[model samples]
Target: MECPVCGEHLGDAGQVLEGLDRRYAPCHACSQARLDPRAPPPEAGQPCACGRRPLDQVMAAVHAVLADGGGLAPGAPLAAVGTPLLHPFPPLRSPPFLPPSSLILLTRYATPSLARRLLAEVPEVRGVVADRGIVPGVGGATHDLLAGCDVYAEARFTPAGPLVLYKQVSTCHIEAPRPRDPKVEATDRAVRRVLPDVFVDACAGVGTLGLAAALRLVPAVVLNDAWGPAAWFAGLNLHANREALLAGEVDLLASYADLRDVPAPAAPEPVAAARADQEILVYRGSLWDLPPLLPVAGLRLAALDPFEKDPDRLRRIARRWQDRAGGEVFIP
Candidate 1:
């Protein structure tokens, strides 16, 4: 998909492998940055020591609003909350996009009202998303949206095609996407080899791995996630990448309850959604809660990309899932 603001191609994921994406940017924010020498780093959590309307100025201002305290202590690193969170998505790890406007601030701080204030006070920031609560995982999978809106979008280009995804970073796991994203690459490689009739993305964070499999011509795929937001985004991305998947009229049949309604660890018999082809089904539930939702006959391949990366756990999962669901599992 094209960038909403800059009208530039965000470039395909394939370009990244060829080392060409570094030069392909939809906005200046993700491109190479030239920091002003004048902008000194933060000292004692204060604003930047230099530059016109220095980044620290904005940082300090935001800090003052929350000085009464929730969890952010004064003098916290500029990074705790992305210091002067930039609008333009930086393509590589580089300096903060300076004087950024027409961009969104992906902050792990601030409240809703405060985010609104920052939006009015800081024109450089088009959006302010305050991240509250823990990231989705085994113990606690719900990340409460404290404030603002998530309008961020990124795409992963495989030979199959471009998979466009929109995720709320605070609620979903933030991925450092590169050409060689091990998890993405591994799943793609494995699916190609196994070419299983049914593929299950047990921990689908926006349907990346599973949808990629769908693009690879995996006939029947099951995508599930415990976290509410992740499950919904998985459904969203399924439709967003429909053209590439060659499925016409991808239908999203999910409600807020189907996603975020269930508590942590255990989910209900999930409400399922189907696309036009009726080959892919998405549900919100724990990994252990997924077998009941699968097709009965196809030889299956499941990827449990859990946050916990213990080798023993993988072995246990392979055994447990194989016994219950009758498929080989991998921790991709």
Candidate 2:
């Protein structure tokens, strides 16, 4: 019998049946095939020797190998399995997973021995680190200490532009450094398409969705978060992309409010010549107290994204803003 994927010959019907049952369709030689025809295929994906056909199964087998921590050997062929597929392959199909490369694996509370073993078994693994006390929540919860590197930098490229943030392992829980959620991004894009004059980012963690809109469409932006640490990081990220923000003709006012007593910062001055093109104001207080500090009439857009785990707060914000006048309010 012949393997349908790589055309490798199987000794007999027994071998074919055994391979199919074990999810090992392609023979060992074909499984280890390299992406480049000229280069020697590295020894990886041997455990996923499933002889499946029609390409998709082969790709799935490869994905399973990487997810299982089997590690794709460096320079092993991935294009042969990935390129021919009609649908989009998973993100894991890329390098460092498909044709494994030097990777730094991060885990929560991973011991030294476990780290060492991971490095040893996976030749492509370059380093490993144990992230301690990282919990999921809003305000001062997530931080990671890399094994070798200092001053972790998170770069996010949004539809608005690119932003770089500096983070350290501290008590404060900030949002994980990554692109904005696709749904959130889509919502923001939809709002920006209307070209609103004023935009408010309520609960702007690292200011991803809000900043994306502020830097692209709106002339003025109010970025507010209940968490001081998150607001601080948002300010840092705003400054990091200051030039771009100014070029877009947007004025930024970032604040940290507890929504109890302290008021939100006022909207940017309407007269461009009277105020700085790009200004940043950071406050530490509550967001509920921000209404008096803002203009009552002309708010064009408001994004209400909170981490309180309750839908009521979002609804209240939406109602308050909507009552003032008719404007688009996005809640995610």
| Candidate that scores best on lDDT | 1
Candidate 1, superposed: residue stretches over 4 Å from native: 1-33, 36-102, 106-113, 130-133, 141-146, 264-272, 275-278
lDDT on C-alpha atoms for all candidate structures? 0.60, 0.44
Candidate 2 off by > 4 Å: 1-93, 97-106, 111-151, 165-181, 247-275, 278-280, 295-297, 308-313, 320-327
Question: For residues 13-80, what per-residue lDDT tens digits would candidate 1 score against the true structure?
Answer: 33323432332222422323232323322332221222123344455445544543453566554445
Query: Root-mean-square deviation of each candidate, in angstroms?
Result: 6.7, 16.0
Q: Which ten residues in a row have the lowest lDDT in candidate 1?
A: 43-52
Winning model by TM-score: 1
> What does candidate 2's lDDT look like per residue over 1-332, in tens digits?
22112233323212212322223124444433334433433333432423223233233343334434434333444432222211111112222122222233444433555445544554333344455544423434444433322123344456665545433223233334333557457656766566776666766665666667755746656666655545655555555455566633223343222321233234421111112553434334455555554444454677777665567776876787677644788775
